[model samples]
Target chain A: MSLSVAMPDRRVRATAAVVVAAVLVVLSVVFACAVGAVHIPPGDVIDGLLDRSDPVTRQIVWQIRFPRALVAALVGANLGIAGVLLQGITRNPLGDPHILGFSAGAGVAAVGLLRVAPEVPLALVPAAAFGGALASAALVYALAWRGGISPVRFALAGVAVAALFTALSTALIATSKLFTQAALAFLAGGLYQRGWEHVHQVWPYTLVGGLIALIVADSLNVLALGDDVARGLGMRVERTRALLAALAAVLTGAAVAVVGLVAFVGLVVPHIARLLVGSDQRVVLPLSALLGALLLVLSDSIARVVVAPGEIPVGIITAIVGAPVLLILIRTRT
Target chain B: MRSSARRTTAILGTAVAAFALLLTACGTDETAVPTATASAQGTATAAATQAAPVGVTVTDLMGRKVTVAKTPTKIVTTSPSALEMLYAAGGTAIARSSTAAAPGIDTSKMTDIGSAYQPNFEAILKLQPDLVVADASAQAPLAGQFEAQLKGVPVVFVGAVKYADVATSIRMLGLVTGTAEKAKTSADAIDATAKQVGDAVKGKTATKTLVVVAGRDGQLSAALNDSFIGDMVKIAGAQNIAAELKQSGQVPGYATISLETAFKDNPDVLLVIVPGNTPGPSISSIVARTFPNLNAVKNKRVHEISLDIFLQAPGPRAADGLKELTTFIQPDVKLGAAVVPGY
Candidate 1:
């Protein structure tokens, strides 16, 4: 699985990985639109996509499956980028948004609002989640700051914050019991019953976070070469790290707000991308985006049809599919 | 996203308030549902002169044939609905689940046996003497172990998920407790209520309805034609819009339906469950955001009903639930008295 490449050959390989992943994402979305509790023929799927299908098929494909698939892909891509940024800034191979308790923070706020004051309009949920995620990131940074932030200490603080927030989220669910199903669905992470509204909600974060990730890639690349060397290279080490962590938090928050806490995409997709395209942030970031979209879209498709009518959470599918694939890639790479 | 997202055991544990009422044509027969049948072996008058006490053989909800070899004086009920049936049948349990509450029964004196899903087995055994009545879906899995732990005490599983199951459960408990006459009176009340509701709404065109059990964050699961609430909706002359949907996984009678299906079905009346203490999103607001064109939104027929009356246990208050449904389904039809329970 390890492709030993010459310096010039690495660029071609990374481009190929990105293209292949992009193609897989499109194919998975099309496949997803074609199959569901109600079976739509390939012709009908295409017609539905083009807004020329019969009323029923159009409703199922355009209104239900299409938007849901897009939401899953967007969430996946955002989380994957977040993972790369977090891992890069922390210099920890195991870093992801969840490791920093970003999802937990967001989950607590969103679940609490839904449980306690369910009358709150649906539009406000994403904003609350975003606020909670940023607040938790700030808390972790403050705890880690003795003189300045240390990567190990920052990561440790994130885990503690995440545990605390996760407990609070659970407490809300157990105590309220009214929205247990809704809270559980969100916590478990899925694109169930999602429509264009969720797609509209998530895409802005993807666009902004992605642009920021691209802009900060070189700084991340510099920071990877040890903190002292990065400083010697005229990179503002602490500021860059904080900026990247905040970017990761925004991305994680957006994804959680829309689809809840989908696991593995943030944690595993970046690793898979690094294995395929090497550690250069510029290459890893885009490659991770494509790979993440492919992974989530494919997993969500499987989630929709595996049990049919009734769906398992997309998170479960991601973990079941992601862990084995990552293991095989790691085993072969070594 | 609703019931299907949950593991079978988790759904059964939490949503055990109702199970499949009757195997509907759409697809409830998928689960191995054992119908409850109580056979009183020998006439009540003949047992008066007999030397031995009269025993009754009853097929419980789990398909287990339990023989009550004498009237159970020290009975323990695990679920709230089971306790309701037991109490209605004139049987007083020595211990009851913490959630068990009947209309007039003062459960303050009874020993609490924890939740219906996870009863304190040790506590139950400490107070138990003769028999244990448990919910079929939630606690039936523990029956073999429980009976073994109790050393020959029979555990009769009763799940009143459907409207009719309430009567069946009461009758079974009546026979077990030697209070068949009292059980008949209570059980007949439910039938009379259903008949009255049906007769009131008979001439009117059936209203198309969508009964949703709201999960947090606007996630909704619909009650199909086979659910306890679904039975009431049918009796009240409303055609359940989710009837065509099949049961998903182990969530016996309810199915997770997509919003598109809901929008397409275009139910005339949309009933949302508002669980206690949480004044969930107004149906008008929800409709405006999601499905403005829906008839329910246009007609202002989207109502938020009590979860206890509509979604929870189908116990002694089942008749009350029927009367409540009739008011919603056919507004012109008036009952003699208000049916809302105080609790």
Candidate 2:
């Protein structure tokens, strides 16, 4: 837990970097709003936000696209923060939200809810998702906890559990004829007709998860050093790690609930941020948020216009971009 | 490590910021949707009638716009619907047809291109058709590739989803092939047959009917509401069970529903369409094994019809299929007189 010798200079530079990232996030949001299959001018996009003339344009901009863009940013930020926390606690560069079986757990629960209780409101999807995610995370943590949560053991257990749950989910979907198409679409992870309802549904979990990640930022910075070192430095390492795991679960669950499974953002963005702003959680966490938001928004925008009147899934674009970044990170780590 | 982290973050931030700026500049001058696009018009009409022997341009169902210098001299039709329309419009077909299972086309002089599920693309190219007409599903995936390869040749893809779309396709083919007068005459005859069937079944009580196209494995598949057979069912005044269970984005293909569910629904009439001589249990035997107590099978309301008439190809013979369906659904409706060959 020795402080880097250039602490003051590092702090100053991190602060400036964060300010720049914040500006980029704002610009990303505006950029997302301006472009879609139906082109609304930037002036009209701004005016639509301000509730000026042209009610149709205003409704399309604010009601349909704006909320979706906001949700993308929020989902991205949540995932980015969760990735940093998980990787820091596990001390594994390959640590991701999906590897922990959170998304599979959420998908299973969502499919079950749709099949058994079709009358349930769309808003309940995330709640069911979060519940399933927490239950699965707890199960994995318990099974992997022999003495301490070994990164390798935890990853192995998580992957195994994830595969099992995913198979169960697929079986359930295939069996029920009524939920087949919806289940397939959900599994594919496209944002075709998403609106304000999805945005309002997942925001609470995202906010809470993000806030908790920020509060435990310092503990994570210590935990990244190693469990014994963190504990010797007066940090409750096990408790801190557990809290971060719960926080990550909430973020991952909420995102999966809203958008099904968006792969690679969680793993790739955090590593990219860590490479840029150092391994310090304080800098890496916020930088991951900005970078994740920016990347997803750009990817979504490209997906929107790549085929006129047709859209490729955002997940496809993210994976195509994120996979190379992941390979580079693994090579660097080795 | 921190400085490296800062530099990576900086590169990502700059890249995103640059894209955002580019989007903002581009967004202002976005192209407007053209107001006068021909597709906007509901009726398929040219702005002005050109003189006789006008060069024809047709946008096929696969969204490929084909321009023919004149009416095609050598045509190869892979779709029975397209062939029926072409023959009914008096086109001189040079070579090739779909299958013996397909109704309406005179397959006596035509070479078979395998089955409807799989078309032999090489055989088709070897036919050297100046114009090729195929179903949309068969042509959609290969539309771009075919367009590139067959640059000089024209391929028209027809989607025979609705009965109205069939008529429209016939008209489009007529316009393109310089057989407008003959197309109109054939279209009128088909429309007349449909009207006669409609008049015959007008006062009959609506019967719940399940029309299934039997697959290779002897499993019954429900034809979609948007499919040609589904349209026939509706026109014949029969309530289709499969149509009732449909949801959006779900392609109406054969789904394996349990015998219990089928019996519980208890359709009054069951029409099974099976293709040429694939040995299996007859529809009656299959029904008896699956649902012995169902009213349709118990009362001998189940009937086996040729796969040709109902499910495989759609054209003038679709009217005949409707007539046959109406007769089966309502036994009192007599389709009297002679059985027409290519009606």
Best by lDDT: 1
Superposed model 1: Cα runs more than 4 Å off: A1-5, A177-179, B1-317, B320-343
Model 2 misplaced stretches (Cα beyond 4 Å): A1-3, A116-123, A177-179, A325-334, B1-255, B258-343
Question: Per-residue lDDT for A46-102 in model 1, tens only?
Answer: 887666775456556765677778778778889999999988878888788887788
Cα lDDT tens digits for candidate 1, B1-343: 2232123223222221121111011022321111111112133334542556566778987788877777788989888878877877778888787767766878888877676644655455546458888887556546654653444466788877678888788888788789998888887776677777877888889999999876544455788888888888998989998999866422457766566776687888988885445466564476667887788888888888766655655687778878877788888888867432222
Q: Is the docking of candidate 1 incorrect, acceptable, medium or high quality?
A: incorrect
In order, candidate lDDTs are 0.74, 0.68
Clashing pairs in 1: none
lDDT of 2 by residue, A1-334 (tens): 3556667676667767767877887777778777765677788889876667364565556655666676787778778887888788678886788776777787788777766655466557667877888888888788789877776677777788889889988777655542144566566676654655566666666555665666567687787777788878998766777788888888888787778878888889988877665777867877787778767777777776665335667889888877787678668874
At residue A3, give the lDDT of candidate 2.
59
